[model samples]
Target: MYETIKWPDEMKPSRSPIHFTNELDVAASVETIWSLLTDPKAWPSFYPGVQHVQLLDGHARFGAGTRFETNLAGQDVHASVQEFEPMTRIAWGGYPKAAEHSRAYHAWIITPTANGCHLWTEETMRGPHWIELAKQAPDIYWLTHEKLLKDIAEVAVAREKSGA
Candidate 1:
Protein backbone atom coordinates (compact mmCIF):
# COMPACT_ATOMS: atom_id res chain seq x y z
CA MET A 1 0.00 0.00 0.00
CA TYR A 2 2.21 2.79 -1.28
CA GLU A 3 1.11 6.39 -1.00
CA THR A 4 2.11 9.33 -3.13
CA ILE A 5 3.71 12.12 -1.15
CA LYS A 6 3.12 15.83 -1.63
CA TRP A 7 5.39 18.82 -1.07
CA PRO A 8 4.54 20.68 2.08
CA ASP A 9 2.91 24.10 1.69
CA GLU A 10 5.67 25.85 3.62
CA MET A 11 8.06 25.23 0.76
CA LYS A 12 5.87 26.62 -2.04
CA PRO A 13 5.89 30.39 -1.74
CA SER A 14 9.16 32.20 -2.27
CA ARG A 15 9.02 34.16 0.99
CA SER A 16 7.45 31.50 3.19
CA PRO A 17 10.74 30.54 4.87
CA ILE A 18 12.69 27.51 3.69
CA HIS A 19 11.32 24.10 4.72
CA PHE A 20 10.13 21.03 2.78
CA THR A 21 9.42 17.31 3.09
CA ASN A 22 8.42 14.39 0.82
CA GLU A 23 7.63 10.82 1.77
CA LEU A 24 6.65 7.59 0.00
CA ASP A 25 6.08 3.94 0.91
CA VAL A 26 8.63 1.97 -1.05
CA ALA A 27 7.88 -1.68 -1.84
CA ALA A 28 11.35 -2.74 -0.69
CA SER A 29 12.52 -3.32 2.86
CA VAL A 30 14.31 -0.71 5.01
CA GLU A 31 17.71 -2.18 4.26
CA THR A 32 17.12 -1.94 0.53
CA ILE A 33 15.87 1.62 0.78
CA TRP A 34 18.84 2.61 2.95
CA SER A 35 21.30 1.25 0.42
CA LEU A 36 19.79 3.27 -2.40
CA LEU A 37 19.55 6.43 -0.33
CA THR A 38 23.17 6.45 0.84
CA ASP A 39 24.90 5.36 -2.34
CA PRO A 40 26.43 8.46 -3.99
CA LYS A 41 27.13 6.63 -7.25
CA ALA A 42 23.44 5.98 -7.95
CA TRP A 43 22.27 9.51 -7.15
CA PRO A 44 22.75 11.01 -10.60
CA SER A 45 21.13 7.99 -12.29
CA PHE A 46 18.13 7.95 -9.98
CA TYR A 47 17.81 11.71 -9.45
CA PRO A 48 18.68 13.20 -12.78
CA GLY A 49 18.48 16.72 -11.45
CA VAL A 50 21.52 16.11 -9.28
CA GLN A 51 24.27 17.55 -11.43
CA HIS A 52 27.14 15.89 -9.61
CA VAL A 53 28.04 13.89 -6.48
CA GLN A 54 31.36 12.85 -5.00
CA LEU A 55 32.36 11.31 -1.73
CA LEU A 56 34.90 13.63 -0.16
CA ASP A 57 35.93 11.17 2.57
CA GLY A 58 34.99 8.02 4.48
CA HIS A 59 33.64 4.72 3.19
CA ALA A 60 30.60 4.64 0.93
CA ARG A 61 28.73 3.16 3.85
CA PHE A 62 26.61 5.58 5.87
CA GLY A 63 27.91 6.90 9.19
CA ALA A 64 28.60 10.07 11.13
CA GLY A 65 31.66 12.14 10.09
CA THR A 66 31.49 11.07 6.45
CA ARG A 67 31.72 13.88 3.92
CA PHE A 68 30.53 14.41 0.36
CA GLU A 69 30.27 16.97 -2.38
CA THR A 70 27.28 17.64 -4.61
CA ASN A 71 26.32 20.14 -7.23
CA LEU A 72 22.64 20.90 -7.15
CA ALA A 73 20.86 23.57 -9.16
CA GLY A 74 24.24 24.91 -10.22
CA GLN A 75 25.46 25.26 -6.65
CA ASP A 76 28.54 23.56 -5.28
CA VAL A 77 27.35 21.98 -2.04
CA HIS A 78 29.51 20.48 0.70
CA ALA A 79 28.03 18.32 3.45
CA SER A 80 29.03 16.09 6.31
CA VAL A 81 27.13 13.02 7.34
CA GLN A 82 25.66 14.02 10.71
CA GLU A 83 23.66 10.97 11.60
CA PHE A 84 23.46 7.36 10.52
CA GLU A 85 21.29 4.90 12.39
CA PRO A 86 21.74 1.81 10.27
CA MET A 87 18.47 1.03 8.48
CA THR A 88 16.58 3.58 10.52
CA ARG A 89 17.86 7.03 9.53
CA ILE A 90 20.57 9.05 7.74
CA ALA A 91 21.05 12.82 7.80
CA TRP A 92 23.55 15.30 6.41
CA GLY A 93 23.81 19.08 6.36
CA GLY A 94 26.12 21.84 5.15
CA TYR A 95 26.40 24.95 3.07
CA PRO A 96 26.03 25.32 -0.68
CA LYS A 97 27.25 28.27 -2.66
CA ALA A 98 26.41 29.46 -6.12
CA ALA A 99 27.33 32.53 -8.09
CA GLU A 100 24.32 34.49 -6.96
CA HIS A 101 23.22 33.05 -3.64
CA SER A 102 23.97 30.41 -1.01
CA ARG A 103 22.17 28.10 1.33
CA ALA A 104 23.45 28.15 4.87
CA TYR A 105 22.38 24.61 5.54
CA HIS A 106 20.90 21.78 3.52
CA ALA A 107 19.88 18.49 5.04
CA TRP A 108 18.40 15.16 3.96
CA ILE A 109 16.86 12.61 6.28
CA ILE A 110 15.66 9.06 5.68
CA THR A 111 13.57 7.09 8.12
CA PRO A 112 12.12 3.60 8.05
CA THR A 113 8.50 2.83 8.68
CA ALA A 114 6.42 -0.26 9.19
CA ASN A 115 5.44 -0.41 5.54
CA GLY A 116 8.50 1.17 3.95
CA CYS A 117 10.47 4.42 4.42
CA HIS A 118 10.25 8.22 4.63
CA LEU A 119 12.62 10.78 3.11
CA TRP A 120 12.88 14.53 3.44
CA THR A 121 15.18 17.37 2.38
CA GLU A 122 15.31 20.66 4.24
CA GLU A 123 17.43 23.71 3.52
CA THR A 124 17.97 26.98 5.29
CA MET A 125 19.04 29.59 2.80
CA ARG A 126 20.99 32.72 3.63
CA GLY A 127 22.62 35.18 1.28
CA PRO A 128 22.28 38.77 0.33
CA HIS A 129 20.98 37.67 -3.06
CA TRP A 130 18.69 34.78 -1.94
CA ILE A 131 15.45 36.77 -1.97
CA GLU A 132 15.83 37.55 -5.63
CA LEU A 133 17.09 34.10 -6.48
CA ALA A 134 14.17 32.47 -4.69
CA LYS A 135 11.67 34.45 -6.72
CA GLN A 136 13.40 33.52 -9.98
CA ALA A 137 13.97 29.84 -9.16
CA PRO A 138 11.09 28.90 -6.93
CA ASP A 139 10.85 25.34 -8.08
CA ILE A 140 14.50 24.41 -8.45
CA TYR A 141 15.19 23.10 -4.96
CA TRP A 142 11.72 21.85 -4.14
CA LEU A 143 11.22 20.09 -7.47
CA THR A 144 14.53 18.28 -7.11
CA HIS A 145 13.56 17.15 -3.62
CA GLU A 146 10.27 15.76 -4.90
CA LYS A 147 12.00 14.00 -7.78
CA LEU A 148 14.46 12.34 -5.37
CA LEU A 149 11.65 10.86 -3.32
CA LYS A 150 9.81 9.60 -6.40
CA ASP A 151 12.87 8.10 -8.00
CA ILE A 152 13.93 6.21 -4.87
CA ALA A 153 10.45 4.80 -4.38
CA GLU A 154 10.24 3.63 -7.97
CA VAL A 155 13.66 2.04 -7.76
CA ALA A 156 12.74 0.24 -4.57
CA VAL A 157 9.58 -1.12 -6.16
CA ALA A 158 11.50 -2.38 -9.16
CA ARG A 159 14.08 -4.01 -6.94
CA GLU A 160 11.34 -5.82 -5.00
CA LYS A 161 9.62 -7.09 -8.13
CA SER A 162 12.91 -8.43 -9.44
CA GLY A 163 13.64 -10.01 -6.06
CA ALA A 164 16.82 -8.04 -5.72
Candidate 2:
Protein backbone atom coordinates (compact mmCIF):
# COMPACT_ATOMS: atom_id res chain seq x y z
CA MET A 1 0.00 0.00 0.00
CA TYR A 2 2.80 2.38 0.94
CA GLU A 3 4.51 1.57 -2.32
CA THR A 4 1.50 2.92 -4.23
CA ILE A 5 1.71 6.33 -2.57
CA LYS A 6 5.00 8.22 -2.39
CA TRP A 7 5.61 11.54 -0.68
CA PRO A 8 8.09 14.12 -1.84
CA ASP A 9 11.57 14.50 -0.41
CA GLU A 10 10.66 17.95 0.88
CA MET A 11 8.73 16.28 3.66
CA LYS A 12 12.06 15.29 5.14
CA PRO A 13 14.60 17.51 6.86
CA SER A 14 16.48 17.86 3.58
CA ARG A 15 13.84 20.28 2.24
CA SER A 16 13.50 18.92 -1.26
CA PRO A 17 10.51 18.64 -3.56
CA ILE A 18 7.74 16.20 -2.68
CA HIS A 19 6.51 13.99 -5.51
CA PHE A 20 3.38 11.89 -5.13
CA THR A 21 1.55 9.79 -7.68
CA ASN A 22 -1.64 7.76 -7.45
CA GLU A 23 -3.67 5.90 -10.03
CA LEU A 24 -7.40 5.60 -9.73
CA ASP A 25 -9.79 3.47 -11.72
CA VAL A 26 -12.39 6.10 -12.46
CA ALA A 27 -15.17 5.26 -14.87
CA ALA A 28 -15.00 8.81 -16.20
CA SER A 29 -13.17 9.71 -19.35
CA VAL A 30 -10.09 11.89 -19.65
CA GLU A 31 -12.20 14.90 -20.64
CA THR A 32 -14.26 14.57 -17.51
CA ILE A 33 -11.23 14.52 -15.24
CA TRP A 34 -9.61 17.35 -17.14
CA SER A 35 -12.63 19.60 -16.74
CA LEU A 36 -12.75 19.10 -13.00
CA LEU A 37 -9.01 19.45 -12.47
CA THR A 38 -8.69 22.70 -14.40
CA ASP A 39 -11.72 24.43 -13.00
CA PRO A 40 -10.79 26.42 -9.90
CA LYS A 41 -14.46 26.96 -9.04
CA ALA A 42 -14.92 23.23 -8.45
CA TRP A 43 -11.99 22.91 -6.06
CA PRO A 44 -13.64 23.86 -2.77
CA SER A 45 -16.51 21.50 -3.50
CA PHE A 46 -14.18 18.52 -3.83
CA TYR A 47 -11.37 19.60 -1.52
CA PRO A 48 -12.88 20.78 1.74
CA GLY A 49 -9.71 22.19 3.17
CA VAL A 50 -9.59 24.80 0.44
CA GLN A 51 -11.28 27.80 2.00
CA HIS A 52 -11.65 29.78 -1.22
CA VAL A 53 -10.34 30.18 -4.74
CA GLN A 54 -10.50 33.00 -7.28
CA LEU A 55 -9.43 33.18 -10.86
CA LEU A 56 -7.23 36.24 -11.15
CA ASP A 57 -7.95 37.92 -14.48
CA GLY A 58 -7.20 34.93 -16.68
CA HIS A 59 -9.26 32.75 -18.91
CA ALA A 60 -10.13 29.37 -17.46
CA ARG A 61 -8.89 27.52 -20.50
CA PHE A 62 -5.57 25.71 -20.09
CA GLY A 63 -2.52 27.52 -21.38
CA ALA A 64 0.43 29.61 -20.33
CA GLY A 65 -0.08 32.86 -18.34
CA THR A 66 -3.08 31.68 -16.36
CA ARG A 67 -3.23 32.70 -12.70
CA PHE A 68 -5.39 32.04 -9.68
CA GLU A 69 -5.51 32.56 -5.93
CA THR A 70 -6.52 30.23 -3.15
CA ASN A 71 -6.85 30.38 0.59
CA LEU A 72 -4.98 27.21 1.49
CA ALA A 73 -4.22 26.32 5.07
CA GLY A 74 -5.10 29.86 6.14
CA GLN A 75 -2.52 31.27 3.79
CA ASP A 76 -3.43 33.35 0.75
CA VAL A 77 -1.45 31.56 -1.93
CA HIS A 78 -0.90 33.11 -5.34
CA ALA A 79 -0.20 30.72 -8.17
CA SER A 80 0.40 31.18 -11.88
CA VAL A 81 0.10 28.68 -14.63
CA GLN A 82 3.59 27.53 -15.48
CA GLU A 83 2.41 24.85 -17.85
CA PHE A 84 -1.04 23.93 -19.16
CA GLU A 85 -1.86 21.09 -21.48
CA PRO A 86 -5.47 20.24 -22.05
CA MET A 87 -6.45 16.86 -20.58
CA THR A 88 -2.89 16.29 -19.55
CA ARG A 89 -0.97 18.60 -17.21
CA ILE A 90 -1.17 21.81 -15.22
CA ALA A 91 1.65 23.33 -13.20
CA TRP A 92 1.97 26.44 -11.07
CA GLY A 93 4.41 28.14 -8.78
CA GLY A 94 3.00 29.32 -5.48
CA TYR A 95 3.80 32.22 -3.18
CA PRO A 96 5.49 34.36 -5.79
CA LYS A 97 7.59 36.30 -3.33
CA ALA A 98 10.10 34.66 -1.07
CA ALA A 99 8.74 34.70 2.44
CA GLU A 100 10.82 34.03 5.51
CA HIS A 101 9.87 30.39 6.06
CA SER A 102 7.68 29.34 3.14
CA ARG A 103 8.11 28.77 -0.58
CA ALA A 104 6.41 26.31 -2.90
CA TYR A 105 5.74 25.22 -6.46
CA HIS A 106 2.95 22.73 -7.16
CA ALA A 107 1.97 20.86 -10.27
CA TRP A 108 -0.55 18.27 -11.34
CA ILE A 109 -0.37 15.92 -14.30
CA ILE A 110 -3.27 13.83 -15.58
CA THR A 111 -2.77 10.89 -17.87
CA PRO A 112 -5.38 8.59 -19.30
CA THR A 113 -4.68 4.90 -18.97
CA ALA A 114 -6.41 1.82 -20.25
CA ASN A 115 -8.28 1.39 -17.00
CA GLY A 116 -8.78 4.90 -15.69
CA CYS A 117 -6.36 7.76 -15.04
CA HIS A 118 -3.04 8.58 -13.42
CA LEU A 119 -2.92 11.69 -11.24
CA TRP A 120 0.17 13.14 -9.67
CA THR A 121 0.91 16.14 -7.53
CA GLU A 122 4.46 17.46 -7.30
CA GLU A 123 5.37 20.14 -4.77
CA THR A 124 8.76 21.76 -4.29
CA MET A 125 9.78 23.81 -1.32
CA ARG A 126 12.76 25.95 -0.42
CA GLY A 127 13.70 27.76 2.77
CA PRO A 128 15.91 27.19 5.77
CA HIS A 129 12.98 27.48 8.17
CA TRP A 130 11.13 24.41 6.87
CA ILE A 131 12.77 21.92 9.20
CA GLU A 132 12.11 24.12 12.21
CA LEU A 133 8.48 24.59 11.23
CA ALA A 134 8.02 20.86 10.67
CA LYS A 135 9.58 20.08 14.02
CA GLN A 136 7.09 22.36 15.71
CA ALA A 137 3.96 21.41 13.78
CA PRO A 138 4.80 17.80 12.94
CA ASP A 139 3.14 16.54 9.72
CA ILE A 140 0.86 19.48 9.14
CA TYR A 141 1.79 19.60 5.49
CA TRP A 142 1.75 15.87 5.13
CA LEU A 143 -1.68 15.46 6.61
CA THR A 144 -3.16 18.35 4.68
CA HIS A 145 -1.79 17.06 1.39
CA GLU A 146 -2.86 13.53 2.08
CA LYS A 147 -6.37 14.74 2.74
CA LEU A 148 -6.39 16.75 -0.46
CA LEU A 149 -5.38 13.70 -2.48
CA LYS A 150 -8.02 11.57 -0.85
CA ASP A 151 -10.67 14.17 -1.52
CA ILE A 152 -9.69 14.48 -5.17
CA ALA A 153 -9.79 10.75 -5.73
CA GLU A 154 -13.10 10.41 -3.96
CA VAL A 155 -14.70 13.20 -5.95
CA ALA A 156 -13.47 11.74 -9.20
CA VAL A 157 -15.01 8.41 -8.42
CA ALA A 158 -18.28 10.04 -7.47
CA ARG A 159 -18.35 12.11 -10.61
CA GLU A 160 -17.79 9.04 -12.67
CA LYS A 161 -20.68 7.22 -11.04
CA SER A 162 -22.95 10.19 -11.53
CA GLY A 163 -22.10 10.32 -15.21
CA ALA A 164 -20.69 13.80 -14.79
Candidate 3:
Protein backbone atom coordinates (compact mmCIF):
# COMPACT_ATOMS: atom_id res chain seq x y z
CA MET A 1 0.00 0.00 0.00
CA TYR A 2 1.24 3.44 -0.93
CA GLU A 3 -0.64 5.04 1.92
CA THR A 4 1.83 6.32 4.49
CA ILE A 5 5.60 6.58 4.77
CA LYS A 6 7.46 3.84 6.54
CA TRP A 7 9.56 5.11 9.39
CA PRO A 8 12.75 3.26 10.16
CA ASP A 9 13.45 2.16 13.70
CA GLU A 10 15.93 4.91 14.33
CA MET A 11 13.58 7.51 12.88
CA LYS A 12 10.58 6.35 14.90
CA PRO A 13 9.00 9.04 17.07
CA SER A 14 10.30 7.44 20.22
CA ARG A 15 13.87 7.64 19.01
CA SER A 16 14.22 10.66 16.76
CA PRO A 17 14.49 14.11 18.26
CA ILE A 18 12.90 15.82 15.26
CA HIS A 19 10.23 14.42 12.97
CA PHE A 20 7.93 16.17 10.52
CA THR A 21 5.37 15.20 7.86
CA ASN A 22 3.90 17.20 4.99
CA GLU A 23 1.18 16.40 2.50
CA LEU A 24 -0.29 17.90 -0.65
CA ASP A 25 -2.95 16.82 -3.12
CA VAL A 26 -1.51 17.73 -6.46
CA ALA A 27 -3.44 18.09 -9.68
CA ALA A 28 -1.09 15.90 -11.68
CA SER A 29 -0.62 12.29 -12.54
CA VAL A 30 1.27 9.92 -10.30
CA GLU A 31 3.96 9.37 -12.92
CA THR A 32 4.52 13.08 -13.30
CA ILE A 33 5.04 13.60 -9.60
CA TRP A 34 7.13 10.44 -9.26
CA SER A 35 9.51 11.49 -12.01
CA LEU A 36 9.96 14.89 -10.45
CA LEU A 37 10.65 13.40 -7.05
CA THR A 38 13.03 10.63 -8.18
CA ASP A 39 15.12 12.52 -10.69
CA PRO A 40 18.30 13.65 -9.01
CA LYS A 41 19.38 15.64 -12.05
CA ALA A 42 16.19 17.68 -12.05
CA TRP A 43 16.26 18.70 -8.38
CA PRO A 44 18.20 21.92 -8.78
CA SER A 45 15.65 23.15 -11.32
CA PHE A 46 12.75 23.18 -8.89
CA TYR A 47 14.14 22.77 -5.40
CA PRO A 48 15.65 25.85 -3.83
CA GLY A 49 18.94 25.48 -1.96
CA VAL A 50 19.61 22.22 -3.83
CA GLN A 51 22.56 22.12 -6.18
CA HIS A 52 25.65 20.16 -7.16
CA VAL A 53 23.52 17.04 -7.41
CA GLN A 54 24.97 13.72 -8.59
CA LEU A 55 23.74 10.18 -8.81
CA LEU A 56 26.49 7.98 -7.45
CA ASP A 57 25.07 4.71 -8.75
CA GLY A 58 25.54 5.71 -12.39
CA HIS A 59 21.79 5.56 -12.97
CA ALA A 60 19.51 8.16 -14.49
CA ARG A 61 16.68 7.63 -12.01
CA PHE A 62 16.42 6.63 -8.38
CA GLY A 63 15.74 2.99 -7.54
CA ALA A 64 16.33 0.54 -4.79
CA GLY A 65 19.77 1.09 -3.27
CA THR A 66 20.52 4.08 -5.49
CA ARG A 67 23.02 6.48 -3.97
CA PHE A 68 23.26 10.22 -4.48
CA GLU A 69 25.28 13.22 -3.39
CA THR A 70 24.07 16.79 -3.32
CA ASN A 71 24.52 20.15 -1.68
CA LEU A 72 21.39 21.16 0.22
CA ALA A 73 21.03 24.54 1.92
CA GLY A 74 24.82 24.89 1.73
CA GLN A 75 25.44 21.52 3.36
CA ASP A 76 26.63 18.45 1.52
CA VAL A 77 24.25 15.52 1.69
CA HIS A 78 25.25 11.96 0.78
CA ALA A 79 22.38 9.52 0.89
CA SER A 80 21.44 5.98 -0.17
CA VAL A 81 18.04 4.59 -0.94
CA GLN A 82 16.72 2.57 1.96
CA GLU A 83 13.24 1.72 0.69
CA PHE A 84 11.66 1.94 -2.75
CA GLU A 85 8.53 0.99 -4.63
CA PRO A 86 8.08 2.18 -8.15
CA MET A 87 5.71 5.13 -8.75
CA THR A 88 4.38 5.00 -5.23
CA ARG A 89 6.95 5.05 -2.44
CA ILE A 90 10.64 5.72 -1.79
CA ALA A 91 12.84 6.66 1.13
CA TRP A 92 16.49 7.47 1.74
CA GLY A 93 18.82 7.82 4.65
CA GLY A 94 21.41 10.53 4.54
CA TYR A 95 23.93 12.48 6.59
CA PRO A 96 25.71 15.75 6.13
CA LYS A 97 29.14 15.08 4.68
CA ALA A 98 30.67 17.73 6.93
CA ALA A 99 28.67 16.69 9.97
CA GLU A 100 28.10 12.99 9.72
CA HIS A 101 26.85 12.93 13.28
CA SER A 102 23.66 14.64 12.06
CA ARG A 103 21.69 11.99 10.20
CA ALA A 104 18.20 11.82 8.69
CA TYR A 105 15.72 9.61 6.96
CA HIS A 106 13.35 11.10 4.39
CA ALA A 107 10.41 9.27 2.86
CA TRP A 108 7.69 9.94 0.29
CA ILE A 109 4.40 8.33 -0.69
CA ILE A 110 2.14 9.03 -3.67
CA THR A 111 -1.32 7.56 -3.64
CA PRO A 112 -3.58 7.88 -6.62
CA THR A 113 -6.79 9.77 -6.02
CA ALA A 114 -9.70 10.89 -8.21
CA ASN A 115 -8.22 14.19 -9.29
CA GLY A 116 -4.55 13.30 -9.11
CA CYS A 117 -2.34 11.87 -6.40
CA HIS A 118 -1.96 12.68 -2.75
CA LEU A 119 1.70 13.40 -2.10
CA TRP A 120 3.05 12.73 1.34
CA THR A 121 6.56 13.31 2.65
CA GLU A 122 8.01 12.80 6.07
CA GLU A 123 11.48 13.29 7.49
CA THR A 124 13.12 12.39 10.77
CA MET A 125 16.34 13.79 12.09
CA ARG A 126 18.69 12.49 14.73
CA GLY A 127 21.92 13.70 16.33
CA PRO A 128 23.22 16.86 17.94
CA HIS A 129 22.62 19.56 15.34
CA TRP A 130 18.99 18.55 14.72
CA ILE A 131 18.16 18.25 18.40
CA GLU A 132 19.53 21.71 19.05
CA LEU A 133 17.70 23.12 16.05
CA ALA A 134 14.46 21.51 17.14
CA LYS A 135 14.66 23.39 20.38
CA GLN A 136 15.66 26.69 18.80
CA ALA A 137 13.87 26.64 15.45
CA PRO A 138 11.16 24.05 15.82
CA ASP A 139 9.25 24.80 12.59
CA ILE A 140 12.21 25.24 10.26
CA TYR A 141 12.01 21.80 8.68
CA TRP A 142 8.24 21.89 8.37
CA LEU A 143 8.36 25.25 6.64
CA THR A 144 10.99 24.08 4.20
CA HIS A 145 9.01 20.96 3.38
CA GLU A 146 5.83 22.94 2.86
CA LYS A 147 7.56 25.02 0.25
CA LEU A 148 8.99 21.92 -1.35
CA LEU A 149 5.59 20.32 -1.80
CA LYS A 150 4.16 23.47 -3.29
CA ASP A 151 7.05 23.67 -5.73
CA ILE A 152 6.63 20.04 -6.70
CA ALA A 153 2.97 20.61 -7.48
CA GLU A 154 3.72 23.69 -9.56
CA VAL A 155 6.39 21.86 -11.50
CA ALA A 156 4.21 18.89 -12.18
CA VAL A 157 1.30 21.03 -13.33
CA ALA A 158 3.61 22.97 -15.61
CA ARG A 159 4.97 19.75 -17.03
CA GLU A 160 1.47 18.61 -17.83
CA LYS A 161 0.75 21.91 -19.50
CA SER A 162 3.94 21.87 -21.61
CA GLY A 163 3.28 18.19 -22.36
CA ALA A 164 6.79 17.32 -21.29
Query: Which has the greatest TM-score?
Result: 3
Any residue pairs clashing in model 2, and if so which?
8-18, 8-19
Cα deviation at 46, candidate 3, in Å, is: 2.4
Mark the regions of model 1 whose C-alpha exceeds 4 Å error after superposition. 1-16, 97-101, 104-114, 129-131
Can you write out model 3's per-residue Cα lDDT over 1-164, one digit (the tens) per residue? 22366667777756887878899999999999989888887787677689767889789988899899987645688999988998889899998887899989988888999999998888889998667766877788898889889998999999999999
Better of 1 and 2 by lDDT: 2
Most accurate candidate by lDDT: 3
Model 2 agreement with the true structure over 1-164: per-residue lDDT tens digits: 22222323443324563333334455556777777777787788766568677777857654566777786655677777776777877767666333535666566667687877776665555564444456677666666666776777777778888777
TM-score for every candidate vs. truth? 0.73, 0.74, 0.92
Model 1 agreement with the true structure over 23-54: per-residue lDDT tens digits: 55665677777777778876776775686678
Per-model clash counts, in order, read: 0, 2, 0
RMSD of each: 6.0, 5.1, 1.9
Arranged by TM-score, best first: 3, 2, 1
